[model samples]
Target: MSSAGVGCLYGVGVGPGDPELLTLKAVRVLKAAPIIFTPQATGSKDSLALMVARNYVDESRQRLIYASFVMGGTSDGVWSEAAERIAGYLLGGEDVAFLTQGDPLLYGSFMYVMVKVQAAHPTIPIEVVPGVTSITASASRAKMPLVSHGERLAVLPAMYGIDDLRDVLARNDTVVLMKVNRRAMAAVSQLEADGELSRCVFVRRATTPREQIAFSLREIAPEDIDYFSMLILSGKKGQV
Candidate 1:
């Protein structure tokens, strides 16, 4: 596709943790895009998404836009404001690339931007590049298969209550729980009570050097995990 004349909106996914796994198309787009946007959680200055995209950015030709996300504030007017900022640049006929860690559409800030930007300017051209998600990276690092044969997989944020997860766990053959912060232990307890403990595996800092994999959930407990950790449970006992 010729990325000329049109004000293109590129939702670029940087992949999970590792820099080398980035797709060639993502790299080329990052290098050629006239403007790049990296969003930071309001208070933080350095953005992990930008750090990964920096490996391919052509500093001479591209301008970086730092779009900050409100941390504690209500989402009342934030979306419209962010959309306006991005629209301002895009309307100027600039190819703007929004850098996001992992797939842009998967639980990412890029989704928010894409929704609002498109709502504000329907004619703007938007392009999305898929990146290796943490679920895949974590599963690979743990040397575990996410799905096999006719098994189904379900992904839930740990932010969902233990009761919600219990229902999902009972139904899905394979479950991937992301954003398992401090509630790790509680989730583990519930899973263990359901007699699914042995089927569980926990991966911390997936695909990175600090990665950790544990087959026994009881041994490590939830308190030891960081915010970046993910928990996977396979329905069949011997599968993982």
Candidate 2:
């Protein structure tokens, strides 16, 4: 994509908290981009995506921007503000690479920024460097393949009611529940009711130094669940 008098906006995925899991393309972009934007919670100072790519960034030569967002919905205004802030740098002809924890298009904060920026600046150069997502990482950590040949898969947030998740489970061969931290116990109860407890496993921060795993869902308590954790349920026997 060619654009006159504007810098490119890159949606870069750093991948599930593991520095080593970062793709060569992600590292290349991080190093080459003059402006790097990371997302953080309103009151938080850390961004997992930035932490994952910190080694590749030269602080003295690059400018780092943190776009804060309210975790659960209600972040529209903030997204717009962030887009404007990024646009300032783009207008100055500095390439901006916004870092996301996983694939930018999949549940990443970058997705929100991407939409706003694209809507506001239709002619701006935009590129996305996809990286590993927690869904597949959780599956691999548990030795569970998300799907085989013809199997269908569904990825849903556990924060929603079980009735919603149950409906998806009924149709898909593999069900991946993201954000299982908030509803860990509820999810376990629903899985038990559906006779799917044994087929599920919990994986936290897959491939990271602080990664945690539980082959049995009951072993983990909702209170102890991490925000980055997930539950991967494979309907049939296919684990290693």
Candidate 3:
């Protein structure tokens, strides 16, 4: 389904907060793409993806576009509309570089937009540029190895049930709890009850200037509740 001159869409993962962590391939795509698309959480004018890649983007020659989505979820046809707009650009023969905070295929808003775009324009070529994931960055920043020597590693959402989380801690050598939002305190409480809070490594804005890392739940402050945070539970030598 290749069109004569249809432009290829690029999903560029900007990396986890730290601009310097951005890959060379990602920077190249950002610089070459004519249109840059950044996702913004509803009610937030700032786009974290743009912030991370601002230094690399040729803002003077390139166009910047923001697509906002409700972090909780959206019933409105927001994704549909965004997809239409992106397809329109592609049909016009302009390459779009969709910037994402993390890897586009992993919990990135680009994933949703991707489904919509592909459904409408399957012929339009799309390339995903991989970047450093938050989980990997968190481990590196904390100097902790997530898994080694055939150890099991599991990642769960913050909204998972306490019973399920308990099972994860028991079954896996390392468990990562991603996107600790308003449930941050409750997650800590459950981990404390399960005696895994002590071994837990918590990080907010990993690899960024605002980064905060805590080894114990007791060390977490009230302001530490962030939707960008992640909790990693790993025992010594990668045994939970």
* Best prediction by lDDT: 3
For model 1, residues 75-173, the per-residue Cα lDDT tens digits are: 536656767888887888777889988899998778888988888788888899998899998989888888789878998777447666666766778
TM-score versus the correct structure, for each prediction: 0.87, 0.91, 0.91
121-192 per-residue lDDT for model 3 (tens digits): 888898999989999999999998898998899987784566666667777788888987656457556667
Ranking by TM-score: 3, 2, 1
Worst 10 residues of 3 by lDDT: 231-240
lDDT value for model 2: 0.80
Predictions in order: lDDT: 0.78, 0.80, 0.83
Model 3 bad stretches (over 4 Å): 1-3, 182-184, 193-198, 235-240
Question: Relative to the unseen true structure, what is the Cα RMSD of model 2?
Answer: 3.2
Model 1 alpha-carbon drift over 4 Å, by segment: 1-4, 70-76, 159-163, 219-223, 235-240
Model 2 lDDT per residue over 26-136, tens place: 999999998999988877778778889999999999999887777755788888999999988888888999999889999988888889999988878899999899888
